[model samples]
Target: MSGGLARCSGSPDRDPGLQPERTRLAWRRTTLAVTVASVLAVRTALHGRAGSGELPAVACAILAWLGFVVVAHQRIRALSTPRPPLLTHRAALLTAICAALVAACGAALVG
Candidate 1:
């Protein structure tokens, strides 16, 4: 008996394992970190004295966070299925590129 548990949409089998849950949580956590970084970048921009590249760095930070959110949301949705597909190279590359952009903004703010 499923004990009143509702089957997840598009998941044919009832998975007893927590692997999918764990993966979803990990994605959420990473997204949260990126969100925090983006907020910090904005705060720094507002408080710090104006610099030549500061506005661009803050804009990039916001755009990168948006990109990561989109990618993470898709990955999280895919993981909901019982047999989630493997991460595509395109998705992986996009995530990495977004992360690098955020990091570059941080470094630029510091310098």
Candidate 2:
């Protein structure tokens, strides 16, 4: 047990660049944006003249919103650890899928 190992002393004393806090804030903002977009997509689906054509867009928006939520949770949990976690391939893939869904929803609204 004499090995040089730093015990968990709760929070760090010195500021670690506040990078984790910034990252948490960024995740929150992204979640908010996704929520707003999803709401808008639902509204468009309800009022659009294309009938069922906008339903897929709404579905995609909802899925994107859920994906964002999962990401936010993962991000928060990762930030809580002593060593910040790197962005995994799964996160990148989820983000890309969400972005594409949002873009599709926007295009559906326009066209």
Candidate 3:
């Protein structure tokens, strides 16, 4: 039966159960995509062999997109769960790590 049909069944509404497995899967997908984007960002940023080059705005954009994905994944997870945010504090650290990696690449360009 469809989810709406199930809800209409005359049964007592227990609770809107969070689909943990699906949430986790979404996180996994987001992480995987971000990882790939990060690699591409690094490669693009390092493309010029020597001398100053234009800032790789593409990489910056990718990084920002990754951050959005992280936020989106977290939001979905929070909505699925009834308790306090399961990812509570990890989001900041994760974003920091990703940002640090991108920064390191940029620094290498300046070196």
TM-score attained by model 1: 0.85
Per candidate, the number of residue pairs that clash is: 0, 0, 0
Model 3 weakest 10-residue run by lDDT: 1-10
- lDDT at 23, model 1: 78
- Give the per-residue lDDT of model 1 (tens digit) for 1-53: 13222444335674677566667788899999989988988898888887888
TM-score of 3: 0.40
Of candidates 2 and 1, the better by TM-score? 1
Clashing pairs in 3: none
Residues 1-111 of candidate 3 have per-residue lDDT tens digits of 134334333345424453543555566676676667666666666675655543655456466657757675666545443233556566767665666656565565546
Q: What's model 2's overall lDDT?
A: 0.71
94, model 3: CA deviation in Å? 17
- Looking at model 1, which ten-residue stretch has the lowest summed lDDT? 1-10
- In model 2, the Cα lDDT at residue 10 comes to 48
Q: Pick the candidate with the highest TM-score.
A: 1
TM-score of each: 0.85, 0.77, 0.40
What digit string (tens of lDDT, one per residue) describes model 2 on residues 1-111? Answer: 111112213456523565656676677788788788778777877877865567677777888878878877887667654557797898878877886788788788768
Against the reference, the lDDT scores of all candidates come to: 0.82, 0.71, 0.56
